[model samples]
Target: MKKTLLFNILFYFVIISFLYSAGETSFNFLKISQGARQSGLGEAFTGVADDVNAIYWNPAGLAQLTRQQVCLLHSVWLVDVNYEYLAYAIPVIGVGTFGIYGTFLAGHITITDENPVTGQYIITDDIARASDINITLAYAKKLSEIVGDNSVFSDMYAGLNINITMENIYEDTGNGFGTNLGILYYPRYQNYSFGLMILNAGIASERPTLPFAIKLGFGYRFSFENILSPFTDEGYYKFSENDSALAIDLIYYPIEQTTKANFGAEKYWNLNKFHSVAVRLGYKFGSDLGLLAGLTVGAGYRLTLNENFQFDFDYAFVPYGDLGESHRISITGKMFGPAETNYFENKEEAVKYYKEGYELLYNKKYAEAILKFSESLKRYKNYAQAYMGMGACFLRLGKKETAKKVYELALQNDPNNQKLKEFIESTKWDIK
Candidate 1:
């Protein structure tokens, strides 16, 4: 019954899209790219919607979030125009994910009039403000909940965005309501993904139509561990995440009766568990602003501040022929670490660090051993071996009290561990 309802909704949505008015849509600013990471990726993020930016690109991606996130983006567009965007995504354990996406665009305009005496254009001393603002509320859920079994349909997700859009040009103002519907499929393995979205599919009071469009996207990622399994352990890299990703997006703008394609690639480098960097290149396949669509360059930096906080910064450089260049930057803060999301993969990496820490401890390098043990625990919180190693490092450094406390904490997590019990009993006076 639920599948029948879903099929009906999707069927009607596609039918209604072709019936909307074309070639005279207002509120065109709705089509502008909103996120830095996406803009750098040639605006092809519909498929790779893994972050808070997904609120705008494809709300269906929000269903994959294990924790909450907030993002702010700013861009200096061509001419005297600039825009700011903010996105927030929060997951509700059993229900679904909720998202808020907003956009504010401001442009400077000069008021002008024609003089009858000389038929000349003269600037008036009147204030002119050209502005646009859009706020959307979104919700997403995985299809598995309705199917009663996750084994087959776990990767399918659907979402909807309700929009409130307003525009102001001098003394004229218009307000409208619209919606975006999207679907995304991403398996647990995290190697590839696909997405479809229909944007701005509603009406306005004053304008005949909105900037309606359809987007289809696909993305793939290649990890070194998988490609170099001959030299790796269990096809998993021990140190960090190193991979290459590629994405392609096809966009059809009904208002203009035009179609375009975008291509993008990114190379990721993880220096360590705490820090990562990436380089991106993107291109659009068509004419843009009277010139051929050119290349776009971008870079990203991410730092894991601690177990509960992570920060990301991204920048994009885009060129527009005679119109000059546009620069975009964004900052995102996430509430959880990678371990909370990729459990098993992180566990594998954690064991490697624990082994290194054990070697350091055997060599009498207490401080270094402590650092490695801490890294291991960061990736897998309940790692009993890592906890024991840290405690031994403190004991060797003459911090008997600290070592006793660490051992006791380990016992709390692993009460059945005979070694931990024996260590606590032996260090009774130190613990007291």
Candidate 2:
């Protein structure tokens, strides 16, 4: 029975969509993109979608998320019009990621009525309001998890968004429903991805035609270290630290018979272990709306609260020619599973640093080697190999007291290891 009800709802929605496509359409508010990051990127986010905002840009991107997140955005538009959006996403282990989102666009206007016979005007209400509300539920799944490995579909992801919309303009009210479908492909190579989507494919009550459109997008991201080594220690560069990305999208409005192009770029700089910043710029072309609606600029900051929680804030500035400018602000919170370790807390990363330290020791770079071993211990305090490496580096630098202390700490983490016991015994004679 539930399936039947869902089918009926979809059938009616399609009929409404067809009826609206035959003539004209309404509900232009649905076309406005949400989230400060996306707006700053000229709405070219279909390919770069990777956050809770993906519920509006490209649902398939939700498959890439592994944690729970919530995002809120508020926009100060021209002429006192206000726009607000909120979204949340959660990942289900072995299944997929699910998300819900809502958007509101509203404004107040003066209402007046005239007596036709006397030609006199009477003020009905000074503060009448119009609003558009859209709520959506979305889901995304990675094909590799479902179809097994070594297949053509392994790199593909699919997602769907179902939305219900309500529009209130003074005394008139309209209701509608629609769906968005999207797919993403990540090639075996790193830093490249592609996405395609069909947007707003459904119908409305008062306005039959939905804002049907199609989008194709491409994105690439690479670390600065990939081209030039920034580490002065003559060691292997870290690939995950500093990065930049570029994305482009081609959008088509079938009903309006128009095509548009969007371009976006971003650079991320890590300030410390717990804080980072991003700068973004975007441009749009081939839009008939306004002459100055092309360029956008924005910035974002991220703070890690702990191993399990993080917070982000973003801002965007968009110009609309004679229509003035719009400012968008967004806040996001992310929470990870208790059992899962974050990037900085992973033992594998510590091991990598420990191995690098061993290499520096072989090259007889005592100070640089000590720094590498200390970095490893910062990530994993119980890393026995890193402690031993630190001890060896100190010994090479003729610091017998430091070497003895370090060896004792290593034995504490590996009390049963015979090699550590022998090393600690040998260090004891040096301390004497």
Candidate 3:
């Protein structure tokens, strides 16, 4: 049987009208991250967010960013499927913050053959495409002053994201409208924070179904200043020189009848004024025990700065099995407004160091290339080439296990890499 998009619409209406006609049907694809870099981190941004991608992770995080930012992500799912996402966060003058997010998923096929009544067999095209998309507008505002300027919780904030979602399969269609409501509590600048959000709560197109969910997360920063203050400026405080941060996140999806929770912590040390390092680990639990384990390791550094610009690099590793490892890098640029001063005036030097890393990888010095790639990534984490280089190096070192793992990791950041695909297959890895 051949099914058309129109048939999909009708079929969906019938299902919504007759079966489970009360709440929203579960739309799981909404949970995917279309970006290459963010996915590499195990989609753990419920807390550690520095970019506009936070719109998807937690709209409340937008209040922490300075620039009006835009991000686009493409993901190739298992099989020959694909997906795309675009997000933008703009700082509104007096209103506080605004964000927009759009997502799309599609691409798959099922082949068939034609059997003639009284003739030879013939081939027929029975390809199918299914897709889902959601567009949302988000707004957040500082409520401290409004609640009470004299109150200790004055800097607290709240936000909401409104979404319009539509889905289409070979013979099914469904539409719904939902909203994500969140509250952010920041007790101090980079010191302590908390958040709560209710996601995908709304009415479906063909029925009164709702995909209700709730997520709550909290974070706190333990800094060097806090640790050293007792030793230097205030010996009266009486303390040791150590600091760490912790976060906990819990989410419940009524539609899917699933609950998830995560606890994450990181210890960071400043090597110098311009250099810093951190070790991150997290444990997640919910529907399955086998799916639970220690998350990964992430390291970040702030490289250089100038009057108008600043650069940052971030690296993370994801270990899949005893023999598999994945690496991730992200480079971020911050441009200070015209009224600010430049901190670093040497762009050529930055580029030179980056190119040198590429050279090391090209020379087939797998081990050295790995280190250089790490350095380059720490300087510029968003560079797709850096991730590719690291994957290639891991592959060349006879680390087919690590190579396959890294290649798959690279796919999270840049899913369109045919080279990574070839590498996985060449190494006898099962991508599917």
- Residue 83 displacement (Å), model 1: 0.4
TM-score ranking of the models: 2, 1, 3
Q: Model 1 — TM-score against the truth?
A: 0.70
lDDT of 1 by residue, 18-101 (tens): 222233677777767777878788888888787887888899988878788999999986554778999998988789999998
| Tens-place lDDT digits, model 2, residues 1-432 | 111112222332333234223235666667777788887787888886778888889999888887898999999866677889999999998989999999987776555556666766665545566677999999999898998857999888899999999987666689999999999887542457899989989988987667889999998776755544324321221224326778899988888777888898888788886898999999888644455668889999989777679888999998866556789999998888431222346587789889999999999998998888877876777787888888888878887876777777788888888978876675544555
Q: Which regions of candidate 3 deviate over 4 angstroms?
A: 1-24, 33-50, 113-123, 206-210, 224-245, 265-280, 287-289, 292-333, 337-432
Q: Give the TM-score of candidate 2.
A: 0.70
What number of clashing residue pairs does each candidate have, in the order they appear? 0, 2, 24
Q: Every model's Cα RMSD, please?
A: 14.2, 11.0, 20.8
Better of 2 and 3 by lDDT: 2
Weakest ten-residue segment in model 3 by summed lDDT: 337-346
Kindly indicate the candidate among 2 and 3 with the higher TM-score. Answer: 2
